[model samples]
Target: MVQSERAKMADGEWYACLDDDLGALRGVAADAVFEHNTLPPRQRGNLGPALRALLGGVGEGARIEAPFHCAYGFNIFLGPGTFLNAGCIILDTAPVRLGKGTLLGPNVQIYCAEHHKEAAGRQAGLEIARPVTIGDNACIGGSAVILGGVSIGEGAIVGAGALVTHDVAAHTTVVGNPARVVSRG
Candidate 1:
Protein backbone atom coordinates (compact mmCIF):
# COMPACT_ATOMS: atom_id res chain seq x y z
CA MET A 1 0.00 0.00 0.00
CA VAL A 2 1.11 3.52 -0.67
CA GLN A 3 1.98 5.71 2.31
CA SER A 4 -0.40 8.41 3.50
CA GLU A 5 0.65 12.03 3.32
CA ARG A 6 1.19 12.06 7.07
CA ALA A 7 3.39 8.99 6.77
CA LYS A 8 5.34 10.61 3.98
CA MET A 9 5.85 13.68 6.16
CA ALA A 10 7.10 11.61 9.09
CA ASP A 11 9.45 9.73 6.81
CA GLY A 12 11.13 13.00 5.79
CA GLU A 13 9.92 12.76 2.22
CA TRP A 14 8.26 15.44 0.15
CA TYR A 15 4.60 15.84 1.13
CA ALA A 16 1.70 18.16 0.86
CA CYS A 17 1.72 20.71 3.64
CA LEU A 18 -2.01 21.15 3.34
CA ASP A 19 -2.99 17.53 3.78
CA ASP A 20 -6.12 17.03 5.89
CA ASP A 21 -4.52 14.56 8.30
CA LEU A 22 -1.51 16.78 8.87
CA GLY A 23 -3.78 19.79 9.38
CA ALA A 24 -5.75 17.87 11.99
CA LEU A 25 -2.60 16.93 13.84
CA ARG A 26 -1.42 20.52 13.74
CA GLY A 27 -4.78 21.66 15.09
CA VAL A 28 -4.45 19.34 18.05
CA ALA A 29 -0.98 20.63 18.75
CA ALA A 30 -2.24 24.21 18.48
CA ASP A 31 -4.94 23.57 21.05
CA ALA A 32 -2.44 22.09 23.46
CA VAL A 33 -0.04 24.93 22.87
CA PHE A 34 -2.79 27.48 23.40
CA GLU A 35 -3.66 25.93 26.75
CA HIS A 36 -0.05 25.79 27.83
CA ASN A 37 0.63 29.35 26.70
CA THR A 38 -2.40 30.75 28.46
CA LEU A 39 -1.39 29.64 31.92
CA PRO A 40 0.33 32.17 34.10
CA PRO A 41 4.07 31.71 34.44
CA ARG A 42 3.98 31.81 38.23
CA GLN A 43 1.63 28.85 38.26
CA ARG A 44 4.32 26.21 38.36
CA GLY A 45 2.12 23.39 39.64
CA ASN A 46 0.53 22.50 36.30
CA LEU A 47 3.16 23.62 33.83
CA GLY A 48 5.32 20.53 33.91
CA PRO A 49 2.41 18.15 33.52
CA ALA A 50 0.98 20.15 30.64
CA LEU A 51 4.24 20.17 28.71
CA ARG A 52 4.91 16.52 29.45
CA ALA A 53 1.57 15.65 27.95
CA LEU A 54 2.05 17.77 24.85
CA LEU A 55 5.60 16.97 23.82
CA GLY A 56 7.03 13.65 22.54
CA GLY A 57 9.48 13.42 25.45
CA VAL A 58 10.63 15.81 28.11
CA GLY A 59 13.70 14.68 30.04
CA GLU A 60 14.70 15.44 33.61
CA GLY A 61 15.27 19.12 34.35
CA ALA A 62 13.98 20.18 30.95
CA ARG A 63 12.38 23.62 31.02
CA ILE A 64 10.59 25.35 28.13
CA GLU A 65 9.39 28.83 28.80
CA ALA A 66 5.90 29.87 27.80
CA PRO A 67 5.01 31.05 24.25
CA PHE A 68 6.87 28.22 22.60
CA HIS A 69 5.49 27.30 19.20
CA CYS A 70 5.78 24.12 17.14
CA ALA A 71 3.87 22.64 14.22
CA TYR A 72 3.68 19.26 15.95
CA GLY A 73 4.75 19.00 19.56
CA PHE A 74 5.17 15.26 19.31
CA ASN A 75 8.14 15.66 16.99
CA ILE A 76 10.24 17.51 19.54
CA PHE A 77 12.48 15.71 22.03
CA LEU A 78 14.12 17.60 24.84
CA GLY A 79 17.00 15.97 26.65
CA PRO A 80 17.90 16.30 30.30
CA GLY A 81 18.84 19.78 31.48
CA THR A 82 17.70 21.39 28.23
CA PHE A 83 16.43 24.92 28.72
CA LEU A 84 14.42 26.85 26.14
CA ASN A 85 13.85 30.50 26.87
CA ALA A 86 10.76 32.48 25.95
CA GLY A 87 9.61 33.01 22.35
CA CYS A 88 11.27 29.93 20.94
CA ILE A 89 9.67 28.61 17.76
CA ILE A 90 10.34 25.11 16.47
CA LEU A 91 8.75 24.14 13.16
CA ASP A 92 8.86 20.48 13.96
CA THR A 93 7.53 19.00 10.74
CA ALA A 94 10.19 16.37 11.36
CA PRO A 95 11.92 15.43 14.60
CA VAL A 96 13.89 18.14 16.38
CA ARG A 97 16.21 16.75 19.03
CA LEU A 98 17.83 18.95 21.64
CA GLY A 99 20.47 17.07 23.57
CA LYS A 100 21.32 17.18 27.27
CA GLY A 101 22.47 20.48 28.74
CA THR A 102 21.51 22.40 25.59
CA LEU A 103 20.59 26.04 26.11
CA LEU A 104 18.38 27.91 23.69
CA GLY A 105 18.10 31.60 24.30
CA PRO A 106 14.99 33.70 23.80
CA ASN A 107 13.50 33.78 20.29
CA VAL A 108 15.53 30.91 18.90
CA GLN A 109 13.90 29.50 15.76
CA ILE A 110 14.45 25.95 14.53
CA TYR A 111 12.85 24.89 11.29
CA CYS A 112 12.64 21.28 10.14
CA ALA A 113 10.42 21.91 7.13
CA GLU A 114 11.17 23.61 3.84
CA HIS A 115 9.06 24.53 0.89
CA HIS A 116 10.04 23.27 -2.53
CA LYS A 117 12.84 25.19 -4.24
CA GLU A 118 10.78 25.38 -7.38
CA ALA A 119 8.12 28.05 -7.35
CA ALA A 120 5.60 25.82 -9.10
CA GLY A 121 6.08 23.10 -6.50
CA ARG A 122 5.76 25.62 -3.71
CA GLN A 123 2.61 26.96 -5.27
CA ALA A 124 1.35 23.42 -5.26
CA GLY A 125 1.96 23.29 -1.49
CA LEU A 126 4.63 20.66 -1.80
CA GLU A 127 7.25 20.60 0.95
CA ILE A 128 10.03 18.50 2.37
CA ALA A 129 11.14 17.87 5.93
CA ARG A 130 14.43 17.10 7.59
CA PRO A 131 15.24 16.40 11.22
CA VAL A 132 17.37 18.88 13.17
CA THR A 133 19.71 17.77 15.93
CA ILE A 134 21.49 19.97 18.43
CA GLY A 135 24.03 17.94 20.33
CA ASP A 136 24.83 17.81 24.05
CA ASN A 137 25.96 21.00 25.74
CA ALA A 138 25.18 23.13 22.68
CA CYS A 139 24.21 26.77 23.12
CA ILE A 140 21.97 28.65 20.67
CA GLY A 141 21.91 32.35 21.34
CA GLY A 142 18.91 34.64 21.09
CA SER A 143 17.16 34.98 17.73
CA ALA A 144 19.30 32.32 16.08
CA VAL A 145 17.62 30.58 13.17
CA ILE A 146 18.63 26.97 12.55
CA LEU A 147 17.30 25.77 9.22
CA GLY A 148 16.29 22.32 8.08
CA GLY A 149 18.78 19.40 7.98
CA VAL A 150 21.34 21.13 10.15
CA SER A 151 23.14 19.17 12.84
CA ILE A 152 24.90 21.23 15.45
CA GLY A 153 27.53 19.09 17.08
CA GLU A 154 28.27 18.68 20.77
CA GLY A 155 29.38 21.77 22.67
CA ALA A 156 28.76 24.03 19.64
CA ILE A 157 27.94 27.67 20.25
CA VAL A 158 25.71 29.64 17.89
CA GLY A 159 25.93 33.35 18.54
CA ALA A 160 23.03 35.76 18.78
CA GLY A 161 21.14 36.46 15.56
CA ALA A 162 23.00 33.78 13.67
CA LEU A 163 21.36 32.11 10.69
CA VAL A 164 22.65 28.56 10.45
CA THR A 165 21.98 26.85 7.12
CA HIS A 166 24.52 24.06 7.48
CA ASP A 167 26.00 21.61 9.96
CA VAL A 168 28.29 22.96 12.68
CA ALA A 169 31.24 20.88 13.74
CA ALA A 170 31.72 19.71 17.33
CA HIS A 171 32.96 22.34 19.77
CA THR A 172 32.70 25.08 17.18
CA THR A 173 31.34 28.61 17.50
CA VAL A 174 29.40 30.09 14.56
CA VAL A 175 27.83 33.50 14.03
CA GLY A 176 26.15 35.59 11.30
CA ASN A 177 23.93 34.74 8.37
CA PRO A 178 24.84 31.45 6.71
CA ALA A 179 26.84 31.03 9.87
CA ARG A 180 30.56 30.41 9.62
CA VAL A 181 32.80 29.09 12.38
CA VAL A 182 34.46 31.83 14.35
CA SER A 183 36.24 29.48 16.70
CA ARG A 184 36.61 25.84 17.56
CA GLY A 185 37.19 24.67 21.08
Candidate 2:
Protein backbone atom coordinates (compact mmCIF):
# COMPACT_ATOMS: atom_id res chain seq x y z
CA MET A 1 0.00 0.00 0.00
CA VAL A 2 1.12 3.50 -0.78
CA GLN A 3 1.95 5.76 2.13
CA SER A 4 -0.63 8.25 3.38
CA GLU A 5 1.40 11.19 2.23
CA ARG A 6 1.71 9.79 -1.26
CA ALA A 7 -1.97 8.99 -1.37
CA LYS A 8 -2.79 12.50 -0.25
CA MET A 9 -0.43 13.94 -2.81
CA ALA A 10 -2.02 11.92 -5.59
CA ASP A 11 -5.42 13.07 -4.37
CA GLY A 12 -4.36 16.70 -4.66
CA GLU A 13 -4.64 17.30 -0.95
CA TRP A 14 -2.39 19.17 1.42
CA TYR A 15 0.27 16.89 2.85
CA ALA A 16 3.56 16.94 4.65
CA CYS A 17 6.49 16.62 2.24
CA LEU A 18 8.96 15.27 4.82
CA ASP A 19 7.72 11.73 4.66
CA ASP A 20 10.21 9.01 3.74
CA ASP A 21 7.84 7.54 1.17
CA LEU A 22 7.63 10.82 -0.72
CA GLY A 23 11.39 11.15 -0.67
CA ALA A 24 11.74 7.68 -2.13
CA LEU A 25 9.40 8.57 -4.98
CA ARG A 26 11.39 11.70 -5.68
CA GLY A 27 14.60 9.65 -5.65
CA VAL A 28 13.16 7.37 -8.31
CA ALA A 29 12.33 10.34 -10.51
CA ALA A 30 15.79 11.78 -9.95
CA ASP A 31 17.43 8.57 -11.13
CA ALA A 32 15.31 8.50 -14.27
CA VAL A 33 15.95 12.14 -15.03
CA PHE A 34 19.67 11.65 -14.50
CA GLU A 35 19.70 8.71 -16.85
CA HIS A 36 17.87 10.67 -19.53
CA ASN A 37 20.12 13.70 -19.08
CA THR A 38 23.36 11.73 -19.33
CA LEU A 39 22.35 9.51 -22.24
CA PRO A 40 24.12 10.05 -25.56
CA PRO A 41 22.17 12.36 -27.84
CA ARG A 42 21.85 9.69 -30.51
CA GLN A 43 20.40 7.22 -28.02
CA ARG A 44 18.01 9.60 -26.29
CA GLY A 45 15.51 10.21 -29.07
CA ASN A 46 12.08 11.18 -27.69
CA LEU A 47 12.98 9.83 -24.23
CA GLY A 48 15.22 7.18 -22.75
CA PRO A 49 13.52 3.96 -21.74
CA ALA A 50 14.25 4.49 -18.06
CA LEU A 51 12.76 7.96 -18.02
CA ARG A 52 9.85 6.92 -20.24
CA ALA A 53 8.98 4.07 -17.93
CA LEU A 54 8.68 6.41 -14.96
CA LEU A 55 6.11 8.67 -16.55
CA GLY A 56 2.36 8.13 -16.21
CA GLY A 57 1.66 8.26 -19.94
CA VAL A 58 3.46 9.17 -23.14
CA GLY A 59 1.48 9.52 -26.31
CA GLU A 60 2.72 8.74 -29.79
CA GLY A 61 5.42 11.13 -31.09
CA ALA A 62 5.64 13.00 -27.80
CA ARG A 63 9.19 14.06 -27.09
CA ILE A 64 11.08 15.67 -24.19
CA GLU A 65 14.58 16.87 -24.94
CA ALA A 66 17.53 16.14 -22.67
CA PRO A 67 18.18 18.25 -19.55
CA PHE A 68 14.55 17.82 -18.67
CA HIS A 69 13.72 17.53 -14.96
CA CYS A 70 10.64 16.54 -13.00
CA ALA A 71 9.81 16.00 -9.36
CA TYR A 72 7.45 13.10 -9.86
CA GLY A 73 7.37 11.53 -13.29
CA PHE A 74 4.35 9.41 -12.54
CA ASN A 75 2.11 12.46 -12.45
CA ILE A 76 2.98 13.72 -15.93
CA PHE A 77 1.15 12.89 -19.14
CA LEU A 78 2.08 14.01 -22.63
CA GLY A 79 -0.45 13.76 -25.43
CA PRO A 80 0.34 12.83 -29.00
CA GLY A 81 2.97 14.95 -30.76
CA THR A 82 3.61 17.12 -27.67
CA PHE A 83 7.14 18.42 -27.39
CA LEU A 84 9.23 19.90 -24.56
CA ASN A 85 12.48 21.59 -25.47
CA ALA A 86 15.71 21.39 -23.50
CA GLY A 87 16.02 22.74 -19.93
CA CYS A 88 12.37 22.15 -19.22
CA ILE A 89 11.39 21.39 -15.60
CA ILE A 90 8.12 20.03 -14.32
CA LEU A 91 7.37 19.72 -10.59
CA ASP A 92 4.58 17.25 -10.98
CA THR A 93 3.40 16.93 -7.40
CA ALA A 94 0.00 16.74 -9.00
CA PRO A 95 -1.07 15.79 -12.48
CA VAL A 96 0.44 17.76 -15.37
CA ARG A 97 -1.35 17.07 -18.62
CA LEU A 98 -0.08 18.36 -21.96
CA GLY A 99 -2.44 17.91 -24.83
CA LYS A 100 -1.76 16.91 -28.41
CA GLY A 101 0.52 19.21 -30.43
CA THR A 102 1.38 21.33 -27.39
CA LEU A 103 4.89 22.75 -27.53
CA LEU A 104 7.10 23.95 -24.69
CA GLY A 105 10.14 25.98 -25.58
CA PRO A 106 13.53 25.86 -23.87
CA ASN A 107 13.74 26.52 -20.13
CA VAL A 108 10.01 26.28 -19.61
CA GLN A 109 8.97 25.46 -16.03
CA ILE A 110 5.71 24.00 -14.84
CA TYR A 111 4.95 23.86 -11.09
CA CYS A 112 2.18 21.82 -9.57
CA ALA A 113 2.67 22.48 -5.86
CA GLU A 114 2.03 25.42 -3.53
CA HIS A 115 3.83 25.53 -0.25
CA HIS A 116 2.15 26.51 2.97
CA LYS A 117 1.80 30.20 3.59
CA GLU A 118 2.37 30.23 7.31
CA ALA A 119 5.90 29.99 8.61
CA ALA A 120 5.03 27.17 10.96
CA GLY A 121 3.33 25.17 8.25
CA ARG A 122 6.20 25.78 5.89
CA GLN A 123 8.58 24.53 8.53
CA ALA A 124 6.44 21.47 8.84
CA GLY A 125 6.77 20.82 5.11
CA LEU A 126 3.13 21.29 4.31
CA GLU A 127 2.14 21.74 0.68
CA ILE A 128 -0.84 21.28 -1.59
CA ALA A 129 -0.84 19.82 -5.10
CA ARG A 130 -2.72 21.37 -7.98
CA PRO A 131 -3.08 20.11 -11.49
CA VAL A 132 -1.82 22.05 -14.50
CA THR A 133 -3.40 21.45 -17.88
CA ILE A 134 -2.38 22.71 -21.31
CA GLY A 135 -4.85 22.11 -24.07
CA ASP A 136 -4.15 20.93 -27.61
CA ASN A 137 -1.94 23.02 -29.92
CA ALA A 138 -0.95 25.50 -27.20
CA CYS A 139 2.54 26.93 -27.22
CA ILE A 140 4.56 27.95 -24.16
CA GLY A 141 7.55 30.01 -25.16
CA GLY A 142 11.09 29.92 -23.81
CA SER A 143 11.67 30.65 -20.11
CA ALA A 144 7.95 30.73 -19.37
CA VAL A 145 6.67 29.59 -15.99
CA ILE A 146 3.31 27.95 -15.57
CA LEU A 147 2.05 27.95 -11.98
CA GLY A 148 -0.05 25.34 -10.29
CA GLY A 149 -3.81 25.22 -11.00
CA VAL A 150 -3.43 27.19 -14.23
CA SER A 151 -5.09 25.99 -17.40
CA ILE A 152 -4.23 27.04 -20.93
CA GLY A 153 -6.95 26.47 -23.45
CA GLU A 154 -6.56 25.07 -26.93
CA GLY A 155 -4.48 27.15 -29.36
CA ALA A 156 -3.37 29.56 -26.66
CA ILE A 157 0.09 31.08 -26.90
CA VAL A 158 2.21 32.09 -23.92
CA GLY A 159 4.91 34.53 -24.85
CA ALA A 160 8.56 34.02 -23.95
CA GLY A 161 9.56 34.79 -20.35
CA ALA A 162 5.94 35.12 -19.29
CA LEU A 163 4.77 34.07 -15.83
CA VAL A 164 1.36 32.46 -16.03
CA THR A 165 -0.76 32.37 -12.85
CA HIS A 166 -4.24 32.31 -14.31
CA ASP A 167 -6.29 30.57 -16.93
CA VAL A 168 -5.59 31.51 -20.55
CA ALA A 169 -8.57 31.40 -22.84
CA ALA A 170 -8.59 29.40 -26.06
CA HIS A 171 -7.05 31.02 -29.16
CA THR A 172 -5.60 33.82 -27.04
CA THR A 173 -2.04 35.11 -26.84
CA VAL A 174 -0.64 36.27 -23.51
CA VAL A 175 2.63 37.93 -22.54
CA GLY A 176 4.50 39.49 -19.64
CA ASN A 177 4.47 38.67 -15.95
CA PRO A 178 1.02 37.64 -14.72
CA ALA A 179 0.30 36.90 -18.39
CA ARG A 180 -1.98 39.58 -19.76
CA VAL A 181 -3.93 38.57 -22.83
CA VAL A 182 -2.50 40.46 -25.80
CA SER A 183 -4.39 38.87 -28.70
CA ARG A 184 -6.79 36.17 -29.68
CA GLY A 185 -6.63 34.04 -32.76
Name the candidate that leads on TM-score. Answer: 2
lDDT value, residue 133 of candidate 2: 97
Error of 1 at 49 (Å): 3.4
**What is the C-alpha lDDT profile of model 1 across 1-185, one tens digit per residue?**
98998899888889999988989989988887777787777764324455568788888888888888889899999999999998999999999999999999999999999999999999888989999999999999999999999999999999999999999999999999979999998
Residue ranges of candidate 1 with Cα displaced over 4 Å? 44-48
Write down the TM-score for model 1: 0.95
User: Could you tell me how far off, in angstroms, the CA of residue 88 lies in candidate 1 after the best superposition?
Assistant: 0.4
Model 1: lDDT of residue 164: 97
Per-residue error (Å), model 1, residue 111: 0.6
Q: Which pairs of residues clash in candidate 1, taking residues 3 or more apart in a chain or in different chains? A: none
TM-score of 2: 0.97
Q: What's the C-alpha lDDT at position 83 in model 2?
A: 98
